[model samples]
Target: MSKMYLELAKRNLQRAKVRSLLAVIGILIGVMAVSAIGIFGESLKAAVLQNFEDVANELIVSPNFQEGYKYLDEKDISRIKKLPNVAEAIPIKSDSLLVESKKKKSYAVVYAMDEKDVEDMFKAEKGSIRLKSSCVVGKRLAEFADIRVNSKITIAGREFRVAAILEDTGARFDINPNSAIILSPEDFEKVSDVGYTMLIVKAESLEKVDDVKKEIEEKINSRDEKVVVFDLKIILERINEAFSQINTFLMAIASVSLLVAGVSILNIMLMSTIERTKEIGIMRAIGAYRSTILRIFLMEALILGLIGSAIGSVLSIAGGYAIDLMILQDASYVFRLSTLLYISLGFSIGVMVSVLSGLYPAWKASRLEPIEALRYE
Candidate 1:
């Protein structure tokens, strides 16, 4: 029975190929618009989360700097270490310097930290970190500079060997880690001032994060000291909130296309009902039930929707890639799984819109009296 209904639906749609194609095009456009924005949003969220994965369990303390340029030094680190629930306080110093390879020159953030403290944080894509007088180049920095293991690069007028190439971290805190250079504290001191820019503190456990943060603030005691505490979880939550608002706004804009598609479906289905009225009346007279007639018409709409959605989903991959290239400038940040899921969602929405839009027309066709429909024709 289902097969018969589907066959009838197929035949009916086939009789008006051009009209069916146009309706499918309308649905495809709607799905594509919604899907493009959804893919971009998911990609952005994934990039942010991936960038923070290594540091999500850590808290950052930096200068409030409301009054003047204040620095976080060893003294503040010592105080924070003594606080209850504290685990370790590691200081990081950062400065921007010109980096030059044989092929290219780029400005890069140079980070100075205790190599032992951040040993586990480094994921090498090409080589290894040997720590003294050697620099670990980020994935992007290595690519941009066209350097690799044993490649010599000059930074801040000092020459160093590229001991390792770190894996690309899709996002970063202040500077993109994928485009940064890591060095030991002592080495960095030789090139620039030893003033610490920030402190990374590990809590005894995730539960102790808030307590550790408060104690550090109390120990620092003043904005003059330039102490500002940032909880990673709170930062993540805020980012999620901001992106949620952005996603909603983007989806609203995309939904306008879908509304237009729905109207197109409604008009097409109504016209189909009028054109097939005599045929419907003949079927009713031949002992076909009203439910069967309705189902057949609804099936036709579903088929159109499914075809449109399939095409749109496939094209969304290209659309997503274009969006990433134009906006994100890197394919590394686009989350593949989430993108596929969003495309599937777009397809489902397109199908649902088509079926719902066909409802009234299907009902009206099912209601046509056999005698009146046949006599009119």
Candidate 2:
């Protein structure tokens, strides 16, 4: 009996091919918009988070110039190291100097730190960090200056060997190592007398980052706000929260299309009900129940929804991949579980809207008086 009703529903939809096709197209656009937008947002967030993954457990402490502090000193470094949950406090001195390599000259940011700290913070893409009379150059600096390992470079009139080239560290708040040079403290003093500029503190563990930051703020800024503690973990959390809100806003905007599709479904179902009135009257007069009539009409809507949502969900993968490539320069996030969940959400919403839109039309068709329906033109 259910099979017979489904067959009837299918046949009825086939009778008005153009109307059915329009309805399906409407649903397809709606679902594709929602799912593709969702996937794009997730991919963007994932790309941003990946850049911060390695540095999230670290904190950057620099002097607050507004408080009359010029630079972070040995005292500040000492205070930070003594704080609870602090693993390592690396003092950094930075200055800009003219660099000459292979007859090419450029100004590059120079950092002065211990060899151990350099080993802990950065990895060499080309050579090792010895930092005796030699220095490590960032990848960008090496490329721009045309310097390589064992190559002699002149910095501030003092000659030094380029011992290593650091790997590119993309988008960092603490230090941009990709366009700078690192030298030992003894070598740094030969060119500039600038004191420590900042301290990079590593927390004992990820969970202890907040505690370490708070302790540094309280202890170091006890008299006045001498230094500012920047917790990368907190920044990461805020970034994730911001992306989540943006994703919700984007999904809401996309849902407007689905609402329009729902209205189209309602109009199509109502017109279908009116056109099939006499046919329904005959069936009712013979033996069909109101519930049976209702199910048949709903089955039509269900079929339309299923067909549209399935196609939309499949197409959304390609849509999402294109969006990710254009914006993030990568499309790997489209296959993530979180992205697929969004596609499923769009599919479910499409089917639900279709069924809901058909409810009133199906009810009206079921309640029609057989005599009146039969007399209608």
Best by lDDT: 2
Error of 1 at 299 (Å): 0.7
Model 1, 97-175: lDDT tens digits are 8888999987889988767764666678887777688988888878887899998999888898988898876755533
| C-alpha lDDT (0 to 100) for residue 152 of candidate 1 | 91
Q: Give the worst 10-residue stretch by lDDT in candidate 2.
A: 72-81
| Candidate 1: segments with Cα more than 4 A from true spot | 48-54, 61-87, 91-199, 204-229
CA lDDT of each prediction against the hidden true structure? 0.83, 0.91
lDDT at residue 30 of model 1 (Cα atoms): 87
Q: Candidate 1: which pairs clash?
A: 63-226, 64-226
**Model 1 lDDT-worst window of ten:** 168-177
TM-scores for all candidates?
0.66, 0.84
Q: Which one is best on TM-score? A: 2
